[model samples]
Target: MKYIVKLNFEVDGSVDKPDVIGAIFGQTENLFGQEFDLRELQDKGRLGRIIVDIKNKGGKIEGYIEIPSNLDRVETVLIASMVESVEKVGPYNAKFELKEIEDVRAEKLKKIIDRAKEILTTWTKEKNLDIKEVINEISGAVKTGEIIEFGPERLPAGPDVYSDPNLIIVEGRADIINLLRYGYKNTVAVEGASGKIPHSVVELSKSKKTVIAFLDGDHGGDMILKDLINANVKIDFVARAPVGREVEELTGKEIAKSLSNMVPFSQYLKKQQESTISVQPRVESVITEAKEQQAVQVIEQPRKEIEIKIPSTVMEEIKKLPGTLEGIIFDETWNPVERVQVRDIISKLETITNGNASFIIFDGVITQRLLELAASKNVKLVVGVRIGGINKKPENVKILTLADVIGP
Candidate 1:
């Protein structure tokens, strides 16, 4: 019973709503006879009023007419056609066009359906979902993706460890992951104290950048620090978690506090030594002299060479990598494990664990510190474009040059 007629009209001169309505009634009268007259239908409540909206612009009026009807479909169509027959309104020559005839009940039903769909979508989302938990899961996945492996041992490390100017060495992969979660990207893990210090870490320390040993607050952390020192890894600073706390479990504020409280490695070591034993004044002098002699000898000695066979595939990769500033790590079976930038090779090595790489071919100079690191990781062969001045070469590691493999 509910029907809406949409009519569009244009008039040559300004006209108001009363003017438009009066014209429709006056023109349509008697044409349909008195039985279907709009005035009689409206008076008896069989039809609603005719509504007109008009706007005057540049001396021309344009607007729409809305007529709600309770008449049958046939009567409604006839009345709409009559409305289009309106040729003049007030003093303006005008033309009316029937835009559409819509069933208001159908539109109301459509709205109900649309609202139901919206409610269902909201309910489904809330059925078994926690907004905070979903966010945490996504964030955790992103953090995990940022972790990478380094060296033959497959040490776990953060991506920024290689790119950042400074580094923080933690005790294990968990500590590295925790630091990464808190937005600390320049972090690597030593894994454990059972094996030698990873060659990647040793070589990285020799780059003369500040390296912090951030360890747990227990006896094990102290042991790890001692082991790193014994292996000749150059640690610049030491940061420790609060007593009874591990690096992996520290809160963000605690982590910041611990790093801020870091002490110089030399100062910390001297303090520890003083607390345990009486020091002779000459001990410092002797240590200083020994360090100076070691530095001098490294510069003066000729690099020793050992005969080692190079695989053809490794040689091919090395050839492709030269001038690219890249390094390729190969597994025990001579398969490529990872390729990294030469500047990041040390940090990359410190991250891998589980004997992930057995050989490394690079387009760079092989330094003494790199040789020691490669040996500690049990990497068997090191191939590069050239060898730098090496004070001493570690056993079990064979160094080769591109000239050595290709035969100058």
Candidate 2:
């Protein structure tokens, strides 16, 4: 037998050993009110339970249960009520029922769980589930903390990038960084060669505003473009770096000139189909300019490779990470785009945004301050390469993927 009993108690400080044990027994004793002596039950161990925490924050009580795997259903529920009462605060309460099915013949257990779920749903509807989380509060300040208000599954930062009347799709986070470094801003990534093109992209392109699929020149990149085209992605062009070079490898000038000459997908496909058309060499001056524009590639020596200041925004993002911001990038069309380096990000900032303006980025974790600042600055998109969420993405703002700003 498992008593599906719960222990809920609000504590001033974070939960400690004493509070845990006390809540368990207090709830258990209340459940058995007169059936057995509290001391006797503890001694016998027949009606005993143990504290198993569910959630905790800054010593304040979060979630936990006492399993009376030794008690019956009625006792468990009675114990649960005591827990709920203990965990209650300002009319808000904590809840989850005790449940046990030793042999799996648990029709009764299922019904109990179902009802408990129903109750929980109702309770959530009536209250702010995140009353504990507020601006500048402990929960909000815990960077990389295991937050439970839900994460990426529920929201992807602020605004969806593809919803813009005109949008660019890149491969992955590195791509986002590069573009962010230069300043294209309205973009998102597919993260890899997978996933249905997001509905936001489909709808925007359907209205005829043009979706540009900026991808790598590799086989995987070609495959992704083909997939999007085949799936009827309403894309207008395919922008790519020179063969064997990704956007990440381009110089600031290379990045600017590429955008300056983006060809529509229709024209690209047409050019590919024309066998009679020869590669027309532009005037010699053009060729010379291209060569001149080729960014100087520096090889590392024993001395530190040109130390440059990472954008304050990028620095802040890295500092707040739970782990390294290392990952492959993909385009919005779901293709392997490129690999990014932490060093490149730092270099790109100094190389591109040099003498431009104050280079700072918003984390986009909350609304108001950052959102207002972005709006006032005419910032159309906020590219968060590491964090993919914002408290809100206001109407004037378009949140982009890391890759969209960098590239595959």
Candidate 3:
């Protein structure tokens, strides 16, 4: 069908779905003549079966209706208007309101376009050449000249490992590949055959201007870095993926952020020391004591930063507002009421009826003027990216920063 007319209806008294359907056909009949009659159109195969869904609430019947049509927009609108003119269902008074006229073909076209893109992506992943081969072909370099295998251990690495002044060490081959895709060629994985630090890696680290240990955000990564330290590898800086995340799965933006936020080895060690929980010595055995300490540290340190519990609906709005410089107003039930640019938040607040807006979330700073206006509107909470200078605090309104809601 080319179009589907959708409507909502209410009956003063309880009624069945069949009653509503009968009323739509009986009342709208003869008004538009025989050619436009629903039954006549159905007989000619130009109209599909009328569908009704209804529910009884407190002796009142309310529901939705859908009527498929192959007619043009004007005819489809007329059909909707005829249905909306329905005033009675059985012996009770009723009201029907037009909701929308959905174009079936347009929706199908959108789905087809999405599916085509997905198929193209899957095919490209399956048929594309290896990363090294593709890079070699593009550079017009010999196969052996761009060799990514490094050291006697034959570890997976990028081609510029020897030429680049800086080096980045990761957990496995996949991490190196991920970095290479983002144009970082001085990456090498420390995954040796026996899971030990390779001697070539130590020597290469000593030769580089700066050596950075970029590992995953897990216990295994910590153990690997400890092993590297025990092997006497020269690591000048330390970078880690987000908590519970692996370097191999990070995007280019994430990789760049991790590298840019890297801390000096000494500072990283200090932070780790501060976060570690103290454990009393155990007399059973040294190994037993060490295992207890490791487990205690992991349990004591929470992966996420301190955050407040927010309704999922509110959280979703907060996630989208960042970087958009937009502000959203929510009702007391946490449903979004209005969305406007940050600069227009004051004007939007003025337009809202008092007590209707309960929450305000925005990308910009929370200033005193906003708090005063929000307080007058009886807003319960105001959350912003940051808080600005404020002389007076409102009693009814609770303020919070964006960081107070999201966790790292």
Candidate 4:
């Protein structure tokens, strides 16, 4: 049926369902014409049987009426109006009110759409490999280097950890294995059954040329860094996976990028201080300009560093850019819009057509010529490893050195 015309009815005296049904047919007959008659429509098979549900209430009969129809909406509603005009049923006064003409096909269509969505969801879940399966497949495909038990604690480590001049310290055994897959053999895990830093790892840190504490990107990583320092591990640099990510779960490209972005240990500590409201002046005195220049040799830290207002994301990018010698352009939202070599910054700035470049972060010296070009392009800030001897500084363009971004 295309439509169901429904309504409620009341009779002054007792009546049965058939009596009310008869009254509707008798009253609405020939109201408009034979074509608009309910009985005629039912005879022609365009209308279905009329259903009446009645009950006794307060010594009077009150019930509902439903008439199924395959006629068009205009014809169905006209039939409903004719039924509502009925005034008597078998010598008893009656009243009928038009309720609604419900379109049956629309409701059925809605249910069909809902069922289709459910089927599609179940089919997708059954046909596709889940995230864990995909990760396992990728992990199994990698040909990783062999791991070895190193030192007295029998820590998980790569073969070259003892002989390599540089060392990388990670959190767990899986982290060590993941690094080994990326050709990084100078790796060791600090985690053991005792959850303490092994004496051999501490001694190796002191002897290695550069010991980088490569850790996860969560609060646990922060705690481990503190424990390493408390245990007197001589760390030279620090690298972390992207926020909320673990070292073991990172892909090869992610591992390379995180290693390339490693920052000096002193600079890392200074950044941690900046996250809080009050920064201790002693932190500035310890990480001196001379020490910071050991890796990137352009910046000069003043006796007292000036604090400037800049986004935290930009500060984070600066900390990662010391030894990489690369440049990154950021849009107003602090997103890295473009990245290029430090030497190609001038050419890149000249070709910028979007005018959305708000900050330039590079690992080189900022000269006077760069400042003029930055001002012409309407760039707001320029940050670099150092500031060279500049004859003039543009008022519109603000320049910051690595020391200024971190601390003294």
Winning model by TM-score? 4
- Residue range 358-395, candidate 3, lDDT tens digits: 98988665767789999999988899765443545676
Q: Assess each prediction's global lDDT (C-alpha) against the native.
A: 0.76, 0.47, 0.77, 0.76
Q: Stretches of candidate 3 above 4 Å error?
A: 116-408
Global lDDT of model 2: 0.47
* lDDT for 94 (candidate 4): 90
For model 4 the TM-score comes to 0.45
- Encode model 4's per-residue lDDT on 126-193: one tens digit a residue: 88765654564465324243778889888889888988888999876657766775678888888622
Q: Each model's TM-score, in the order given?
A: 0.35, 0.31, 0.39, 0.45
Superpose all Cα atoms of candidate 2 onto the true structure and report the RMSD in Å to 1 decimal: 23.9
Candidate 3 local Cα displacement, residue 276, angstroms: 9.7
- Per-residue C-alpha lDDT of model 2 across residues 179-279, encoded as one tens digit per residue: 54444556665544343454544454576566778776543355456556655778876787655445544555676666667797778777755855322
Ranking by lDDT: 3, 1, 4, 2
Which candidate achieves the best lDDT against the true structure?
A: 3
- Residue-pair clashes per prediction, in order, are 16, 42, 0, 0
Worst 10 residues of 1 by lDDT: 277-286
RMSD of each predicted structure: 22.6, 23.9, 22.5, 21.4
Comparing 1 and 3 on lDDT, the stronger one? 3
